[model samples]
Target: MTAAAPSATMRLIEASTMISQGAEAKIYRARLHPPAASSPSDPSAPDGCVLLKHRFAKQYRHPTLDGALTRARVAGEARALVRCLRAGVRVPGVRMVDAAAGVLGIEWVDGASVRALLGGGAEGEVEVEERDDGEEEEGEEEAHEDGAEVALREYGLTPDQVMEMIGAELAKMHRADVVHGDLTTSNMMLRRPSAAQPAAELVLIDFGLAYISTLPEDKAVDLYVLERAFASTHPQSEPLFAGVLNAYAKGMGKDWTPVSRRLDDVRLRGRKRSMVG
Candidate 1:
């Protein structure tokens, strides 16, 4: 007796486990079985499952506008992932794309997020003790260091080494003209080394906000956003970030000078350039 044909995306979604959700999309983990072979003796079976990101419909916006935005964003993200892969950047591979339905399936990464490896917990869900003005308390650096020790042991990486990896990877992406609009630790992952591969690789994910640009200002703002994230989340991350910049400088080669200068200027003025005189 033969079985019915697989429903591809629908079947994958039905069997998938909802992993996470954000304002823009929901992610799931599931097996993306290949289309049935035309020949019985074919030898092209895929090994395993993939991660699916579905940009579900938004009811807040007008129906036509919502549909257009979802389709465009899905296609844009898929294109960015393909561009990064071709540029030798370690990002998840594109497995499937359904822009009409706003679904993208990509290679599943089997590891923890960089934020979790840095002792920030999954999704960096640390409780921020608030001051009178709602700013986080300033004395949590000591506690952060203590937690980081255990986290470092689990991942077998020192704080300096992690910073260096982050910097080098970002430089490569910038060289490829891919600007990751969101450069948070949460968007990066350290893939676990497999039997076939000895060394763990750092991968950048979540390209929904990514775009192609060679502008130094855009690159500077990318680094600035990361710098601010570290300041807020990791407490006393100056030396670590400095190590990142050192590796980044070497990776960026001659292009490092302008980006470094622009980064400084950006720091002084904050992320936004004032429109009014």
Candidate 2:
């Protein structure tokens, strides 16, 4: 007998434009049609475009094991997103889910990544500078800071305000027990401000490695991860991160005391605990 063919969702993913590929999954920008009742006037109406995250099969694992893991991860991510939404966290809404095929569809966000907005170069774009004497350039250090200010102005916010938004959003997520395993500027997005929504909202994305946890250590580690990301990606961002922490404390309220103290301890010991036997 011949082997079974791929499912419709898999076929759709195959036809979609592959936007980004990582070790765990491949992201695609695709248009999906809504249910018949969604738009009666246009029965064949498209459900608008979406960002699809397709978790491909892992070759190393057994077929059954791989399928189980993929489905579990897809389900976990979808659950986390829904939980965040209900908790008033600003994140992309889920549009579709195909756990069997390991495909998850989310609303397409129209703005640039936070990394790009901060002038750290566009998503996936890297710049390598070659110096003859292998020495530092004098004014190069100030270039990103200046560009970031201009970018923030376009969004009607200052660097400090942006940091505050980030902190608040993360605190909201943690309060809901949703731990974003990977926290980086590249994972955050600033949706373009509009008349209806005057403020440029900060959206957290890429929850492939997220889970539910209420531990203070977990929450502190989440903040620490973001702090390190800022230190590495954005130069002269110490004050900006401080602003984020301040806002985070306010959002966390009474719970902030423990997490704040844990954060200091995390910084001292680093991300990983010493594995001394």
Q: Pick the candidate with the highest TM-score.
A: 2
Candidate number of the best lDDT: 2
lDDT of 2 by residue, 132-156 (tens): 9965477765775777889888789
Q: State model 2's lDDT.
A: 0.85
Error (Å) of candidate 1 at residue 167 is 0.7
Which regions in candidate 2 have their CA more than 4 angstroms from the true location?
2-5, 34-47, 122-136, 271-277
Candidate 2 positional error at 57, Å: 0.6
State every prediction's TM-score relative to the real structure. 0.84, 0.87
lDDT of each: 0.82, 0.85
Misplaced by over 4 Å in model 1 are 1-7, 34-47, 127-143, 271-277
Candidate 1: residue 211 Cα off by (Å): 0.4
